[model samples]
Target chain A: MYAELTRRSAWHDVLPTVLGYIGIGVAFGIVSRAAGLSILVTLATSTFVYAGSAQFVLVTMLVEHSPLLSIVLSVFLVNARMMLMSTTLSTYFKQEPLWKNILLGTFLTDESFALGMNKLNYTDRKLNFTWFNTVNLASYLTWIVGTALGAMLGSLITDPTKFGFGFAVTAMFIGLLYLQIISDKTISLKLQLTIILFVLILTYFGMAFIPGNLLILVVTLLGCALGVILKHAHN
Target chain B: MPTIKFIFWTIFCTGLATWLTRITPFVLLKKFTLPPAVIEFLNFVPITIMAALWFQQIFIQQSGQLPAIDYLNLCASLPTVISAVISKNLLVIVVVGIISAAFFNIVL
Candidate 1:
């Protein structure tokens, strides 16, 4: 796989993803710093976790002093869709080493998965894993570098609240939520999504009196369970 | 302040869970087909989790209480929501959000 992964090949196919990841990664770094994470923690989270939206959520939880279990669970649930994405993309994998496939799975972001799937659409039986690996490599490197750049800039602004960077994560989440809703076009689907959202929001607001340790975990699990049941009934 | 150990554990756990999500399908389900119900259930998780997170951030205060109105955030969210609906670009939406929130903080 490594033999054919030329720099030219990776960049040619993944330019858009490279640019997109850099932009999002920079934003995550700035917000993570603004939320009071040390530069080291910011780098560690981005380098280790590599899930953009979940990183923002984790930063928010850290800022607010949410319990550790809650933070982990929330991030997990947010990134869980990777399971489906990875599964779909794995179907087209050629007979590469199992380790390579597993390693590649670790790098699977939404943008990478989309690009890989689009490329896979052209092949009949023998899929090209190296090209897709190049795409992942490009996206991954840009993301890490962009975050480092943003963290440096974020460090300069001592009072992040003054620039409203405190609200950056919320803004990002809203945008993502809007995209999720608009992507699904059926009236019934929209209705179900709305119901699920409403129930989750209510649980969050209603659970304020509970102990901190149980609040986030219970609400998150409850919300997910409700969503699953709702989908079962609707379909 | 959070201890180093707590933060480390949080990061490690999040990374582990995320890795599991990314790896399980490739390893365990390569030759298997997931039930329709299970797939449907997974489909709904993203939206629900995000909505919970969004509302929690916007509506819940630091003291674990809901305010009468988070006026600044609510006002800023108007632009964010509008740009997201119209442009559907992540960069644009984030820029609008940051600018709107900053503007409201300055003006009001």
Candidate 2:
């Protein structure tokens, strides 16, 4: 019965997610510790914030003793896309209970959300709130464990940078980007180039005028607007 | 900032970020239906935003220097991209990319 139940569940999708989360979470923990955050704080951030990129940026800023407002602003900007993520998820999860939605919403990191969405597409299943909760719980547990390990071993370890562990997050992002490009029929090379150029230029200028996090916000929103206009014109 | 102060600020910012972005669309769309054009636009937002971020990470730098043919990144990225194109396996491509990047970084 247990095996049957496990087989019926979407644990297959959950395995890759666990691996990805644990690897990335360990990297975040190491970076956070190296940035001078205590293990407690590292664990807390992973437990509460649960946003890897934002957490990394926050730690870097804290180490620099950046202004509080600036730190907050940067994190806010990096995670602004979470809004879009939650919104896309809501369409799938509308029929689920409000409390469940809110709870699951907090755990909706990029990787889990993307995995859940793709799974939904493949199964052609309506958003099953139970399945989402199971996937997220598994991911969250793995992340916390990985974070703890990284934090504990952070000081003892040497040359993580030499190993390009820092780039693991970037590699994950690249992998996710490749998946999106391949899966979506509507995405075009020209459109991709335009957004990339716009962000690079905007980021260059934004760093001068706006704070770091806010710069991400401005660039992202501007990219969204430009994409919309370009797509509209094309069609 | 003190550690405690920074922690508080981080939490506050997390709350603000969560509420502002996550709640806005639901509140706006719950009562009102967005136009088709807007929905279509929203569909592309994820891919475009992600692409912008990925490109920026790979190509851009903060030292006021242009990304002038990062041979190491290229060497690593070439095999990575090839694996991605041919095999289409996420794990394989990532392993190849990281190994190549690290090997090149150490050697050259």
Candidate 3:
């Protein structure tokens, strides 16, 4: 394990995520601090919870003084995507010890998972436990560090939106999705685009009545079922 | 004012919930083999999830109200999406997004 950690640094593998996470973590810290959270509370949430999007939700809920139960439910709903990602990435670790897999669970953000999935799809190399741990730990620490910085300087950055920091993760996701689609040979680009368009329409039309997270969960589930049916029909 | 006790409780609840979601599949699916169709579906699920994420960011939806297009977001995102298509690099796309957003803010 120590050898793999020193082999190549593998820093390049997680460099992009590091950049995005810093911006996001700072934005999160700014928001949390702006919401009147002390620096200690902001750091505590960022360090312990570490769900990027859910952290945003927590800040908003804190501002509103929302009930604890609803806040927990909101966190669960937003982070449920991790369940899907964790399950999908599980087979990649069949050879590793259970403790390693459990340890890896700490670093499973969307960007890291996308990077991992892309690595799996586009490369011939096997998933190295050390490499993933490095990626996970580096990204995780970057987020915490950025949050600390932001919380420390939160009063200075009174307006994060003016710098368009809000769109950072969206852009990252778009880039990841674009890479995933272009690199994937198993799925047709046409089919994938179709699903995207379908989901966008559903989201735009239904978001008025449904919560965004809940709507996404439902749409993804139904769309996947439909995708499977279509795949069979085409075959 | 929110009390210190309430805030800590909220944090603990959220931390526990998020950890549960992350740990559930890892612990439960060790012996299970997912069906091939389910696997096929999972392949396409990411696209839907990504689409929802992008659309959620791009649109402005008030609670219990019709969604409206945020033209500024659309304008800012256009270049980033284009860069994503042409470059397919995360760093480049993010730079393009931030620059374009700033540019749009200035020009429009």
Winning model by DockQ: 3
Q: What lDDT does the true structure give each of the candidates?
A: 0.68, 0.66, 0.78
What DockQ do the predictions score, one after another? 0.42, 0.39, 0.68
Task: Indicate which candidate wins on lDDT.
Answer: 3
For model 3, what is the error of residue A92's alpha carbon versus the real structure, in angstroms, after optimal superposition? 1.9
Of the candidates numbered 1 and 3, which has the greater TM-score value?
A: 3
In Å, residue B41's CA in model 1 sits off its true spot by 1.2
Q: Which ranges of candidate 2 are over 4 A from the true structure? A: A1-10, A186-219, B1-32, B63-75
lDDT of 2 by residue, A1-235 (tens): 0112133464665664465566677888888888778898889888877777788888887878788787777777778877777776676666555666676776677766666544543454355766777777788899899899889889977445466554544455566566655655555767866766777676555555554445455666777788888877888
DockQ of candidate 2, scored on C-alphas against the true complex (2 decimals): 0.39
TM-score, second chain, candidate 3: 0.88
Off by over 4 Å in 3: A1-9
Q: What is the TM-score of each candidate against the true structure?
A: 0.61, 0.79, 0.93
Instruction: Please say which candidate is ahead in TM-score: 1 or 2.
Output: 2
> Scoring only chain A, what TM-score does candidate 2 earn?
0.76
TM-score of 1: 0.61
How is the predicted docking of candidate 2 categorized under the CAPRI scheme?
acceptable
